[model samples]
Target chain A: MFTPLTVALAVAALALAVWCGWAAYRDQPTKDWHFIGMAVVSVLALAQLAVGIVRLAGGEDAAEGTVIFVAYLAAVAACVPVVGLISLTERTKWGSLTVAAGAVVLAVLQARLHEIWGGGGGA
Target chain B: MAPETPPREPRDPGGGPSDSDATARRASNAPARSAGIGKGPGTLLVTLYGIFTVGAASRSAVQLATRFDEAPLAYLLSAAAALVYAFITLSLVRGGERARRAALGCCCVELLGVLTVGTWTLVEPSAFPDATVWSDYGMGYLFIPVILPVTGLLWLRRSRSHGGPAAVGD
Candidate 1:
């Protein structure tokens, strides 16, 4: 629910998307470094999830209702790792592109999270 | 994984060395066939469809559960879209001649659904109290609902051709 964290996660996600897209453009598969990038984004997303849960427990409410907000948080936390695993299975340029697609989706979800909270939970 | 092992060539049993060599060369040049439909760009398509499956299914599930009376048609359409996406995603992962054919057929139906829903929403916006995945040609989801089926059809056709080698071996 923190403004800075949401923005940071979106930025990190988009950056990861661009990095993975570049790898695909170079006709390369996802490498160890790309997984590291996924980890970085995942960590931030997990932090956001934690913050959202704690805030909800503290009696704060999301504008879009608690259930959907929590669902989005859980989804955000799970996105990158699952996509990374899928990419790991296929060692080709398309694997890189898959990660890129996942990262872009993560960024979109992050924006929606902000909207779901009514853009009012600023730190 | 597996240390990126070289693609295995099918045994020719009584074929000459030159024939085996040529087969190995061909196999290396087109590994997509051996790897199945889930390889190459299909990997990306599967990922996208997987996401859409989760997105549309969960969204419709919630909508149908909470407000079935308000917009039953739209929510039901959303659920249908989710099923189509899930089927395609599974068929891609379960690669083979039969799975490829099933996916191709589903892709055509999906394309038709999107076009019909898109036009219906445009021509009569008041009819839909809420948007389905295909509403306005998937404008809500960046028009991916329309584009995905077309892409899936192309990929399926290409994979079918690539399956020729594997088919002969089977």
Candidate 2:
């Protein structure tokens, strides 16, 4: 319902995508900056999960298939945590990069989800 | 001081074609157990491939199950493409002599699939209604399917030497 959460998630995801691309372009290990960017993405993703569920429960229909919308929400929601866990096990810069990149994918998909709910394509 | 990636040892991608440092880095994707399944680029590639496999498979299934009669050729091609994605994912995660060969073979097939299917889709529009993984050179996926094999072939070629038992799946 509220776009604040969606906007936040998309923004964070976009920022991180940019950051990660820069890091990769420089051929550098993902660093503290990467983690910070990822943290923001993760928080926003969680918010999306919360808001999406509420939107769905409020009798709103997903113009792009409710099942797919829910699936995308769940995917966007759990992606950060799942990748975070995996990254923790690695303890390498690549681990951070992995998590960061995962968030970028999540954000991209979340935008798509919004389009689905709005009955439109990407902005 | 500016951050820098560690100096990478020059390597190979196993039994495939082409050559490049970028492709060689895929060789670092150690077997699932030793390096863990999520270790290097291979892990990421495998995960991405797995997602694609799922996406393609579900798409085909949904299309076929709901409206098979509408576009049988397109749906069938979707199923086939999904199978190829699954096959490539399996071979990568499996990582053994057999797996390597399987991956190599699949990569080759994937290339041919995209090429033939791509050309055919344009030549015979009547055949495909919507789209398939290999349709019009994977236009839907931005040709990632087409590019994947070339990368795969190069990676497999580079991995051939150090690719012995270390390539075995966990």
Candidate 3:
């Protein structure tokens, strides 16, 4: 895994989380800008997924099992889009809160991905 | 630009929409006529339960498939937790009177599972070589497992009370 990219993804996710959380607290629906923010975060996550896969293809391995690492990568890549769809189903402020929660979960997953790559075993 | 209009006065002391208008709008736009358990805040709860269902199921499945011999008890408990979460998620999304009751029963079972497994793990550390979802009251998953059922039960009660006059008399 690319450490820098992973850290960047985590930071971006955290930023988006805080932004969405504030919007939810204000009882505001998720606006267009929030979708844009989600897109940016999703791009970063996809990039991380690609990089992780490339490293594995080149005979690199995570400290944990390759299957688990790849699973995390796939899950992280899918998280934002899935959450975005769920958010669309909800037009209220709760939609924004759902996105906020998704962002927080993504950030947490990113951290776990980093730990897995750095030889940390099962979380 | 046209001349600026005067700022509108706040509708309520809380600076929100008037209660009647809000209620009327909500009634119109709500997903269900009766505003079943899956509306409004229930959406958020469903999302959360869905996430946990995936988390716990996948974790336990991987563990059982790869190394079940290492900790059968733990993996089995994890699988059980996953099933409970899955049931609750489905029930919440389905959101009828029956579904609400199912979810309530599941939440009660979940709370019992968490408390039982939590105390068991503390009292007999050797029993769980690996952690289950309810182990240590879900300390690994930030205790959301422990808190979720409680929140679910409360929401179920509130939704029941608000269900209708029929529910009130029952």
Identify the CAPRI category of the predicted complex in candidate 2. incorrect
Q: In model 1, how large is the Cα lDDT of residue A91? A: 71
Worst 10 residues of 3 chain B by lDDT: B1-10
TM-score of chain B of each: 0.78, 0.71, 0.79
Candidate 1 lDDT score at position B95: 72
Backbone clash count, each prediction separately? 0, 12, 0
Ten residues in sequence with the least summed lDDT for candidate 2 chain A? A87-96
Please provide, for model 1 over B1-170, each residue's C-alpha lDDT reduced to its tens digit, 9 standing for 90 to 100: 11122333333322223334455457436534534656667778899999999999999988999899898999999999999999999988777666778899999999999999999999998889888999999998888899999999977786555442333221
Estimate the TM-score for candidate 2. 0.74
The alpha-carbon deviation from the true structure for residue B118 of candidate 1, after best TM-score superposition, in angstroms, is 0.6
**How well is each residue in B44-130 modelled by candidate 2, as lDDT tens digits?**
556567667877898898889888998898899889888988998887775655566678898898888889999999999988777
- What TM-score do all the candidates reach, one by one? 0.86, 0.74, 0.87
**Candidate ranking (TM-score, best to worst):** 3, 1, 2
Residue range A30-114, candidate 1, lDDT tens digits: 8889999999999999999999999999999889788889999999999999989988876766778899999999999988899
Choose the strongest candidate by lDDT: 1
Model 1 TM-score relative to the real fold: 0.86
The lDDT values for all models are 0.82, 0.66, 0.80
Model 2 agreement with the true structure over A1-123: per-residue lDDT tens digits = 456677777777777767765654444445666667667777777777777778788888788777777778877877766666655543444444566567667766766787888877432
